[model samples]
Target: MSLRRTRSFALTVVVCAAVFTTACTVASPGSPSPVASTAPDAALQPFYDQKLSWGPCAPYATTATDRTAFANPKFDCARFEVPLDYTKPDGEKAEIAVLRQKALDQDARIGSLLMNPGGPGASGMSALTSIVSGGIGGGPLAQRFDLIGFDPRGVGASMPKIDCLTDAEQDAEREKTFADPSPAGVAAADANSELYAQRCTERVGTEVLANVGTRDVVRDMDILRAVLGDAKLNYLGYSYGTRIGSAYAEEFPGNVRALVLDGALDPQQSTIDRAVDQNAGFQGAFDAFAAWCSQQQTPCPLGQDPKQATTVFQALVRPLIDNPLPAGPGRVLSFADAQTGVSQALYVSAAYPILFQGIAGLATGDGETLLRLADFYYDRAPDGRYSNTIEAFTVISCVDEERITDRAQVAELNRRADEVAPFRSTGRGPVNSLDPCAFWPVPPTSKPHVPQVSGLPPTLVISVTGDPATPYEAGIDLAKALDGRLLTVEGNQHTAALQGDQCTDEIVTQYFIDLVLPPEGAQCKLA
Candidate 1:
C-alpha cells in the first residue's frame, strides 16, 4: 500500500471494525452497557490456580507446513465456542479459533497477554502465531509471556463467517468503483454499495448484527478471560483494538490487570465525528509525505515540495474520477477504492517504500504495481478472492455509525468532504460515507459514547506526530482520558509499537515490564 494511500485510510480503532472522536468525554451510547461481573471473591483461591500445562496442541493443524504459518512452536491452537448473543445466555453459539503461546518462565509468568490485530477482521489467531514465533514482544519478556490471539466474532476461522460479496465480486467492485472517485466513474460503486449492503443484511440477519458491536465483543473477551482462568485481563490493543481495550476497561474496570493501548481510538465520538477526525488525520500524513517527497525530489516522482506532490497526486486522482483505468482481475478501483488503498498504506512506515514504488509506477505510466497495491489495500487478491473483512466492515459499520442515516445525508456528507478536505474531500464522501450501512436492517448500536475512567491503573498510549489515521491529537486525548502517559514519536505514520522506533519501544517495554510510564510531555524524535 502506498504511504500516500495508507495515510488516507480510516484508522478504525475498534468501534465498527475499520475506524473518531473529540472532547474529554463524549456522551455514552443510549443503551446501558453490560456491567462486568466481578471475579468471585475467591478469585485468587487455590481452585483458580491450576498450573497451565504447556505443549504443542497439534490436532488443530495438520503438518509442519501448516504450523509454519505460526510464529512460534509454543503456540497451541484451540477452538472456543462463544454465544451468538450474550443476552440470550444459552443463545446459538459460534466457534472462535484461538492461538496460545505459553510463557517460557512459568514461575515468573504474569498472566495471559491477549493481543488483538485491529481489523475488526484481521486474524488475531494468525497474528498471534506470527508475533510469538518471530518474537513480537522481544527479549525474556517474549519467553516469559503467553501471547494469545483469537479471530473476533464473524471474522477469521470463526463459524458462520459473514461474507456478503465473494472475493471476486469485491475485487471487481474495488477495481471498478474505487480506483476512481468521480461521479461519472462510480456507477458500479453505487450499485455495489447498495447491493453489498442489501446482501449483508440478508446473509447475517438482524440478530447477528446486534450481537457484533464493541459491547458484545468485549463480553466475548470477558468470557475468554473466565475460561483462561485469569483473575484480571491483561491486554495490549492497537488501532481498533484500543477501543476494545477501553470498552473492556469501562465495563470491567476492576478486571484490568495491565493495559497498553497504542495508537488508541477515541470512542466518545459518533461514527461521522470519528470519520471526520480520520479524514483530517490522513490529510496530515499526506502533508508529511508531501514534505518528504519534496526533499527527495530527485528520487521521487511527485514534485519536490509537499504542495506540489499533493497537487500532482490529486491531479492523478482527478483524471481517474471520470475516466478510470480498465478493470482487471475482476475488479476496478473507484474513488473509494483509491481512498482505501491510500488509507491502508499510511498506517505503517514500512509501507513508504511500496508507496514510492507505486507512485513511480503510475508516474511512468505503468499502473500494475500501484493497482496491486490498491487491490491489497482493498483486501482483493490476484485470484479474485477477497477477505471477508470488507463485508464485515460494511455490516458492522452500518450498525454502529450514523454517517449513512439516509441517502440525502450521504450526499450532503460527500459535499461536506469536498469543502473540509478540498483536494480529497469530494472523494471522502464517496469513499468515506456510510452508504453500505444506509440500508442495513438494524440501526447503529448507539453513537460512540465513553464514560470517564478515573482511578485506573497506569497505562501507556503511543501515537505518531504525523499519523494520518488516528491523528496524534486523538492519542493525546486518549492518554489524557485514561489518566495515563503518552509517548509521541516525532514522525509520520500510524502505530509506533513495532515500527522500529527504539525510543518508543523501550518506553513500551519498560512499561510492560516495570510499569513505568513515560514522564509527562515526553516525546521521541527520529534521529
Candidate 2:
C-alpha cells in the first residue's frame, strides 16, 4: 500500500479519491500566521469566511483511471480562494482545491487529517486518492480521522498554476545530454535555464509565481484549517511536504494538534549544501544496491566488484550522450534520461528490480524500460500531456531559496556534486553555470534559517539511514530544531510512515489518534 516513489512520481497510479460529499466547516477563526494571536486584516475576511460547496468531483480527477479508482459514492470536490499576496489581501486571489475522505466511523472521527505528498509541487489530491485506494478506509486510524487533501497554491487544480514547458518542449529537455560543466556546456545550460525562467514567467504572469513559496502555502494552510473547522491541524507530510509542515509548526505552533514529518528536509541547511548532501546520499544508496546485486544468485550486472558499480554504470550510460540507444517509436535513451531513470529507481528499494531490468535491457541494445522509468519520473502521460509537476517544482523552489546568480558558486556546487557522486562526473573537471532560479521573475520569499518555534506540542520526525533524497541526518537535524521525537528507521527508502509498516504505523497511529509521542531516541528496523 506504499506509493513510495520520488516526489513527482507519475500521478496516474496515485490519482484522486473521495472522502465525504458534505460541505467543509465554514468556521473562520483568527490565526497567528506571522503575528501571534491576531485576526487577518479586514479585507481578507471574505476569503476567510467563505463556505466550500462540495459537488461532483469527477471533473477534478487527474485521469480517467483516477476517477475509476476513486469511484466511491462519497467523493466530492470544492475550491476556496486565498489572497495572491497575503500582504495585499484585497488584491487578486488564488484558488485551492480540497478533497476530503470521510472516516468509516463518524461518531469517533477526529478533525481532518490533511495529507501532502512531497514535490513541494505534487498534487495533494492525487496523493490522497492513491492513499485511499491503497486501503486506508478499513484501517484503525481511518475510523477516527476525516482524511483531507488539498492542492496548494499554484499547483494542480489551483487557478493559474505555475507552468513552464510544453509537452514537446519537456520531451526535448529529457533528451538533452548530461550537460557537463565545461565552459561551452555551462553556457548552453545557462541559456536553457534563462529560457525556462522566461517561459515560466510568460506562461503564468509574474504575480502567481511570486507568491507560491512555502511561506505563502503556510498562510493558505491556516485558512484551510479555519474553514475546515479544526481548532488545530493534524498533518502528515512526507519528503518536501515536511518543509511546509515545519514552517506551519514554526509560524502557528499553537494551531498544531499533531504533526508527523517523515523523510524530513533540514530547514537549517542552505540550498547548495542540501544538494551536495543529497548527491552523496544517492551515491551511498547506489553502493548499497550494487552490494545487494552482487549477493544475488545470478551474476551481477556490474560484474563481481560492487565498488566498481559506478564505473560500470557509467560505461553503460556515458556513450549515450553521443549515441542514444534506440528504445521504441519516437523515443531513444539519452544520457540525461539514463541518469534520471537510475536516480528515480534509487529512491526506494522496491524499484530496484525495475532498475536492474532496465540496465539489463540497455546491455541488449533495448532502452524501453529505462525510457519508461524516465517518463514515469516526469509524469508524462501516454498521450504526451505532462502533469505540470516539474513546472511547479521549479517555481516553488525558486521562491523558497535565496536567488544565487554567481556562476562560480554554481560551478563549486557542481564540483562537489561530481566529487561526491562520481557516477555523473565527466572526469574533465567541474564546470560552472547560472541556474534557472537566478533568473526567476519573483525574488525568493524566504531563506534558509533555523525554525523559530516555541510552545510547540511534541511532534514526530522519521528518518531513514539510507534515504537518498532527504538524507538521514536532515531528519535528525529537523527533530533537534523542533525539539521533537526522532524515529530512526534502518532502510534505503525516501520515507517511512503510514506506508504499511506495523511498527511505524502503530507509532504514527498512536501519535495522531491520541497525541502520543514516541520515546527519546526511538528507532525501528524497516520490515
Best by TM-score: 2
lDDT string, candidate 1, 338-448, tens digits: 555555555654455566665676565455555665655455544555666556655555555564556465555555545545547433345433355655667666467
For each candidate in the order shown, give its overall lDDT on alpha carbons: 0.60, 0.78
Give lDDT tens digits, candidate 2, residues 21-42.
Answer: 1101111112223222435568
Q: Which residue ranges in model 2 land beyond 4 Å of their true spot?
A: 1-38, 178-180
Residue 383 in candidate 1, Cα distance off native in Å: 3.0
TM-score of each: 0.82, 0.92
